[model samples]
Target: MRIVIAEDAVLLRAGLVRLLTEAGHEVVADVDTAEGLLKAVEQHEPDFALVDVRLPPTFTDEGIRAAVLVRSQHPRIAVLVLSQYVEERYAAELIASRRDGLGYLLKDRVADVDQFLESVGTVGAGGTVLDPEVVSQLLVRSRHRQDLELLSPREHEVLGLMAQGLSNASIAANLFLTESSVEKHIRSVFTKLGLAHEDGGNRRVRAVLRYLGYPDPGPGHPSSAHPSHQEFRP
Candidate 1:
């Protein structure tokens, strides 16, 4: 797969290039600044990009903004972000857009080279991969809802898979269940969460997003389980 990398750190940037290059994948462009990163993306049009959360000019969310811009302008480009910390707000911004092919992970995940490559491949294939840490944080924030507390452990596992943006088949494969059973579990989950919506094509994704308090607020859009009038703080 062809890739563009946007990271501020010199060592990590070089290491990622070496790793991808050694693994037989092409690293089309590796740049330090967010502007240069976007330029490289525009010029080379790589299949996927691995971006860091922080970059030059302002070491605060410059790369994140660029990634969002890429997703908006080039809907086809898969983008994975590696950040020092998992911010629910950032995840909400990414998921708010209707398109897929997105990932947000903690920086430490880089230590597991093989697994990291696997995630890169998954997102590049139009899948969404969220860090388990991010998932946990979202869940904790959503726990105030009595409906969420009612989910059985197995059903909760299904919800997590849904949040990762996996389809029924993929979730079934991951959970070692038949696709039919996964569908059944999903139906039950929607019922339990009181999130039944025929218009929302991907109810599972919407459910997970709502459960995480990032509803779309449209016909099929997610409604706030937690209202927008409320402010969530760290």
Candidate 2:
């Protein structure tokens, strides 16, 4: 897939370029600053962009701001953020009622190369991919939310995995439950949360956003089939 990368760390940026290049995907551009990333994406119009939370100059929210801008200006380009810190506020803003082709993975939490590649593919293919730590942090902050409190423990597990952008089958494998059981739990979540949308993917995104305190962007955008939770062991 065509791609652009934005990270200030030279070694890490080079490693990402080399890693992705060797894996047979083309790296159209790799830049050190958020401006460079935006320019590269606009110039190459890559299928997706892999960004860091921080970037040059300020080393603070530059990369994320660029990411949000890319989404706004070029809705077709998917985004995956890799950050050393959680940056909960930026995460929520980036999510902003959209889940597909979006990801937020903690840099230190990316334990395996293969898993990282899996997540890359997930976001590239328009699937959601949140780091489990990101999911936990987002959820913990919303535990007192009324809609969230309606979930059963099993439903909550399913909800978290769903927020992580796992397919029903993947969630089943992770939880050691049957796929049917996973579907049932997901259905219950929708019922309890009042997200009775016609599209399954829409409902999934809505549930995730509801817990995160964002509303669905609109109706009818299809959700992508999720990849396995590869960053950690089941």
Candidate 3:
């Protein structure tokens, strides 16, 4: 895949560039600021962009805003943002606006080079991927928590695996279920979540996002930090 990387930390940026390049993916542009990210996207029109959630100047939501802009402007450019924390509202906002070819992963996930590359490929191929921590944190703030309560414990587990971009086979293996059983549980999740009309891979992602609170952020919702967010990050 051809890619652009926007990260403020010099060493991390360099490491990413080296890693992607060594893995035989093109690094079209590597920049440190959110504005630079936009400029790079407009210039290169790379297949995907790996961005940090925070970038130069304010270091708060810059990369995310730029990512949203890129998605709006060039709908074809896949974007996967790496974050230092499990940013709750912005993550949901980004996903709610455009779920396809999008992802939010904690930086530590990058340490698992093979899996990180797989995530890059997944998002670039127009799939959604969220780090497990992001899903867990987002669930705590779910505006539809009661809706989530409608799921059976098994269905809940299935949807959680779905949120992590796991396939039915993978989810089955993880949960020690047969693939057919996994599919049944997934369908139940969709029906209970009222995503029956959502359809195909889209519904699965939609259901996972909905169950995990990736909808429009409610104004009444607290903007305070979620306790789970603090527990996971290094």
Candidate 4:
């Protein structure tokens, strides 16, 4: 795979370059500033970009802004953003881009090299990948919302795993349930959240996250209005 890295810290940038290089992936461009990162993406058009959520020249949300721009402009290039904190707002914005090939992970997760690489691969392959910590924080922050309150305990478990980018098969394995059972739970989650079951891929995930109060800032995205709540008959 080809990758472009956008990180301001010298040592960490060097480490990422070495790691990706050693993993048999080519690092097409290594840049320090958000502007430079955008330029590199335009020039290289790498398969994936590893971006830090904060960048030089104010360091607030340059990286995230650049990531969203990439999704809007390039669309084909996958992005995995690294953040020092689990900023739910930033995560929501990135997901609001409503693109598949996106990931948000805490910088601390880099220590687990294997899992980090797995996340990279997953994003590169056009899948959404959210850090477990990010998912946990979002769950806690939105637990009081009525949409979330509508879910059963098991459905809540499945929704959390789904937000972590787990497929039905993986969620089933983790929950010690059959894949069919996991699918049923996921359907129940969508129905309770007032999201259409036919809305597969990232749209469904975004709807669920929006219902969780992350608030998709995407243009024309639906507001958090629930369909008439129906009892879970199973």
Model 2, poorest ten-residue lDDT window? 224-233
Worst 10 residues of 4 by lDDT: 225-234
- Which residue ranges in model 3 land beyond 4 Å of their true spot? 143-234
For model 3 the local lDDT of residue 88 reads 85
Rank candidates, TM-score, best first: 3, 4, 2, 1
A best-first ranking of the candidates according to their lDDT comes to 3, 2, 4, 1
lDDT of 2 by residue, 1-234 (tens): 999999889998898998888888999999999999988987999998999999989898999999999998998889999999788789988998478899999997455789999999989999999988778767755653777888999998888887776788899999999999998998888888776656555667667766555434444643222323222222
What are the TM-scores, per candidate, against the unseen true structure?
0.61, 0.62, 0.63, 0.62
Residue 153: error of model 3 in Å?
Answer: 31
Q: List the residue pairs that clash in candidate 2.
A: none
Which scores better on TM-score, 2 or 4? 4
lDDT of 4: 0.82
The candidate with the higher lDDT, 1 or 3, is: 3
lDDT for each candidate structure: 0.81, 0.82, 0.83, 0.82
- The segments of candidate 4 whose C-alpha lies over 4 angstroms from its true place after superposition are 147-234
